[model samples]
Target: MKYSRLSIWNIVVKCCMSWVILLQACNNSNEAIEFVSESYGEAEIISIDPKKDIDEEYSMKASLIVSSIDYFPLTLPGDMVIGEVAKMIHHNGYVYIFDRHTESIFIFTGKGEFINAIQRKGGGPEEYRDIKDFEVDRSSGNVLIYSPRSQKILHFAITGEFLGAINNKVQHTSFFPISDYKIAIYNSRLSNGHVFERTFPIQPRFIIANEAEEIEKQDLETAYREQLLMYPNSSFGFYQVGDSLRLMESINSVVYGVDLEEGRVYQRFAFDFTSANPPRLYDMEADELSTFVEDYKNKKVGGWASLHRVNETADLLHATYFYDKQVCRIFYSKNNKSQVNIGASWMNDMDNIPMPLVETTTNEGELLGYYGSDMLSMIVKHGKSKPSQRILDLEKSQRDAESIILVKFRLKDF
Candidate 1:
């Protein structure tokens, strides 16, 4: 006895539906993100421009307000004179300063009230010499102070207690703590013209893997092959999280993020460095390159290159490029992490700011020892020009007098 045609058709449909379910399971398995040992291409600045609607007026307005605030004059406790301020860090509701001349660390309230000195020049614990930079551990309340001359990043308690030190032979240009156990270190040198990174084992000893060395370790051939794997034509920056590195870049001036684990670069950002114009290139002689690099590494020339984390998702990112005499630009991320814009500070009033560049070996004719901001600020030595004139006679040639200008900026939606 055979079944009706309609019944046979219904059975066939049920079998087809069962097969579809099995196929869906297989597709999901294949779609899982696979691990690969992909390399990345050499990064270069593609394009950048000042953000629209920003101008000298806005930056001036902001500076005038911040300057007038009733902040205390930073003072050096004890025998220290609090010489020149190398950097001023705002953390834990306080402002920390590093004085180069006195070789001491000064602490102040957020509003600029002089609190106390953290360390002094000595060859023992609780002492420091040639302190280059310092970073605060927001979570553990520990502080990491780097003395480039000493080539060490010393850990200390926020209250001036000494902790262990990490001897990462690599000269740390900068660093950001991702947690109590891990940190991302940015390294660069005048001898080498590239910026690279390394992650340390979060322990106080901070043992670094040899493979996490400089970018030179990566050959050109590897870069070409992995170039496609990189977020299509984007500017990238790195952040640390435990043993992982967060890759950030801009598309059309918009910032994007990627999470990296075990050498894999995760693409998390959506924006790209946006510039319709091609990049501007300049080639200098070997001697000139050496001089420029040395000045930058030794902190002789006044300029700053730093990274900032924008939002909680830790998705947004920005880079601050500070030029001497107060003119600088902020590269900000756009929506969808696809584009970034180079925006100027309209509030700091940096128009007509003087940018002074000098060679240290030939310093007899110059008065300004260095140029930069008050915090992480460079030294301005006595000059040949009279104090009344406020002139910087860089050379006997009698260059015209110009005033130094500084600007401040914050993020805003257009």
Candidate 2:
């Protein structure tokens, strides 16, 4: 069932932002993709009125979705350290973390053991001066690090051995390897002078291009751009469920499923959050932008604009988003067609303990969340419910470490 990396997606300016996605495939694409109507299409919209959903107080138990959990104490030896985790992906029994502070990718085992790192921070022809992001070659298990500093995607073995590099025209950052030949770029707006003047034609948010920098596939439909002179660290991300590669847009409510081997986008989702006072700042003036920012900061607008990360089971679609200028998780039942608000983190009622961390989702049926040892110490000291014996022992072992504790749990088909 090996498929060629036939398409690229979500390529553009990758600067001062963050994105972590582990793309997987099942059998096919399409998650609630239906053409209701052109101009009037609220029929298929999965309306999530946060105020109503949050009040219902739906809770999901840790034991319900997960049969087990593993806490990985991510670490490095001596002066080496995993700085800030810009993006984390758990795939194939390995956890790959892109460290933003050090601009390196650190690899670890599934059970909290250090393996190796994929970093060559230097100014050589085979070296990358800077790494904007990294991705794992699903078909080959190779580590591909995208370096804007040297304009190449350096390939390396899982053992940190340099294999080679691919030349890319993606200048602003945020590009990923779709295959050995194609790359995905997310060029939302003109972020820099080079892209504005020389690189690409005016295109949509997602574009697939070959090494020659020729556009291969792009959606004809477009979105209005915000003129903030800055882009969200993750403009858009691609996630995989079963055999489907799904997309969760960073700025809007629509989600898509893509068949990369065929180079077509399956419009998988469209959510109507009008009940949540979503922002409307398209073509807004500077003064208008300032007003919107201040109002949002003062809690005047609903916090349902950006769709960050999403994971899905057969019964539920889970995601995280910018909620009132903070991160919060939202669960939508496919059958119910409405949002199910499960506290800041999973309520963990089944475990009868509070997980004091915000988590992200993956279509791979995994929940990824992280907390430093300091917070773990606090949770053990003054938490309401009793944590599992495993957590308490972890807190004892990592009492004075400079690394993060990654919470990895498998999800069930709710």
Candidate 3:
């Protein structure tokens, strides 16, 4: 006998609730505390201690070295301009960049040669009205585009062939593909009957589904209800480590390892945020929760963990967070058991040469960073120091070019 998706999900939820109750009971027991301490002996606690002065500079160990800087060719046929990049992925010797402004995916060679754009945008069949997010299925060499408006996952081959789409019922804000047939969808802004009825607190935020149907869902209702109220736009961070998928809530300190094959959470690592912990909504009354939510929106009460990514070796963890109305980048290394606050001054050896923002990790275990076309134009116009020969040559080759700058680097081991 086979169970339906809904039935399976219900069973899973009941089992999870039982586990939650058991965990809660254990939390109240001394034996549970001892067990937790022993179990998490390898876990590292990171404390955020901001300097008295915001402008205080801390020396970062130059472990990662820039290997090469290359520019994507801007001049394609029909004079297409690669607008602001929404997301970038390097796979199989091809660079896939999704331009938010144009709402199109552009394909390029690893050396930045323009190949072709995916399908054109439309409301017709095999076309997407809006692309909320996208991911490449490397195993099948297919590009999957999520269209929230159409509620579909449009599929296309890397060679620009249009495959059929999977009909999606859930209204997801973002999605990450776990396999060629499976994906994890997240919805932060949930409505119940009305827009401001305050029913979103109980809705499930994460769901796992396959191409043909939904699989299972997880909702940390007690832990996320307050977080959703405080930060309506907060979402989960999805990180891929080999075959395992890790999910981290934007405002929470815990990172959960998701078992894609089993459709359940396998393990969890809770980061210790000593002083910068956000206020919980469950602990506050209605009026107090409202006040705290307002303060949090105004950047007064709580900080948020916006993005998190771990290196391929699993030794270094890089995360971006907001605290005291300032955005901060942090590097925590498990190998060295050290944490470094990478403040506003993120530059390379070249004076005034800012390091490109790391967008994602490549298959080869190198961090891929991008310099937008606008930034490249500004650098060419008003850069104080000498530009790289590659940049100068690219500028000379294509007059009025609007190409993206690519930088690849790996975290230096201390």
Candidate 4:
């Protein structure tokens, strides 16, 4: 029997609707699978710069020590190696030097006289296994110490009394405190079923890591895993600038902004370093290989930036995507304006540059300075040069030179 045209049309429409539903379900399932795979396996690094050599000249200049005109010779525990200063936090006229190797915290008066050591190795309320970083709450006159390995944040009175610990849950492997109540945390994940986690929270925040999916190219996966192990969660880093909190995410080495206030995120920067000269990977699946080819076509291999808070502002520093160059472009936001500038030779080519050494106009276009770096590297790579591991000396010399600068200006009439 022949059906009515209307009836036939209705049947056709129902079939089409069913197909649409099936397609949508499949798409969602694939997404879920991909996400689960992302957690189970790992991605590969098609290319990288194997140059691990620390430039000696750069290290020397970066670690240069000078006589303190005021207080001098901050005393550290004899057991702790007074490695080159990794970071200098000046508050209440005292300089706190965090030594990486010695895992010690040394305090000195602004006049350069040694004060008392802040902490020793203990799990009690007053002690720390390792102090990853420290910052002064200028407004509160409180010292905040972040111990990533211990997963704790300790608040200390200016006189070295432990006031209390910041109570919150976090999963960052590394962290930097931005203020008395704020800190940035870094979390990373690798495929060997090993997770590197550290927590720095005065707020309700969580760091989640998922194992990556297994790719056909083991070498690429190895490289990606290795880099991730060295510094993972580049995209998911959290930074606190004053009262504003910033979360940065990375997708394929491109940087994205996390709208914590809005609970939304989007890509803002891309690093395509590996696009031109793709790295070698053997026997990648067609779909997997296509990603690299597309990256090469887009010239987006090495483009990436990480977030760090400098003097109460979030600075996004990035390297040329996919390129092995030792350069970082910094993006700073201030006075409701954003400025971008290049911090050259921060580690290697830091000499001859005076105070306010590096400056730039950011995406929103503003200028400000307070010299910042992976000072931890200075301690981690100490003794490569012949300079005495005097953190106070290094800090004194740098405080006078190379610190962020401010240039005076006025709007001119055309």
**Candidate 2 lDDT over residue span 1-414, tens digit each:** 121210112110111012222121111212212212222233245555544545323454656545566667876565565546667766777778887767778888766688887667899987889877778776676788887768788899899888888787655334556888887765444443343344334335566778676668765334233444333323356655565666665545567766566665655776555544234343355576666555544445433435556666556677655443344556666876655555344555544445433334444566666766655666667767777787788889887675668776665444
Off by over 4 Å in 2: 1-44, 53-68, 75-79, 171-173, 191-201, 220-235, 277-305, 313-315, 333-339, 350-353, 356-364, 412-414
Write candidate 3's Cα lDDT for 15-114 as tens digits: 1111111110111112111111223333345556543343224322233433444445543554566656667777767778887767888887766778
lDDT, model 1: 0.34
The lDDT-based order of candidates, best leading, equals 2, 3, 4, 1
lDDT (Cα, tens digit) per residue for candidate 1, span 62-163 = 333223211123333334444354444454455555555455566665444567766645666555566766676756646777666655567777677787
Model 4, position 8, has a per-residue lDDT of 22
Q: Report each candidate's C-alpha RMSD, comma-separated, in the order given.
A: 24.3, 10.0, 12.3, 21.5
Off by over 4 Å in 3: 1-44, 52-75, 178-181, 192-201, 210-235, 266-273, 281-287, 297-315, 350-352, 387-399
Q: By the lDDT metric, which is better: model 1 or model 3?
A: 3
The alpha-carbon deviation from the true structure for residue 268 of candidate 2, after best TM-score superposition, in angstroms, is 0.9
What is candidate 1's CA lDDT for residue 72?
A: 22
Candidate 2 weakest lDDT stretch, 10 residues: 7-16
Question: What TM-score would every model get versus the actual structure?
Answer: 0.44, 0.75, 0.74, 0.42
- Top-scoring candidate (lDDT): 2
Which is better, 2 or 3, measured by lDDT?
A: 2
In model 2, state the lDDT of residue 275. Answer: 40
Model 3 quality (TM-score)? 0.74
> Distance (Å) between predicted and true CA of 356, model 4?
10
Better TM-score candidate (1, 2):
2
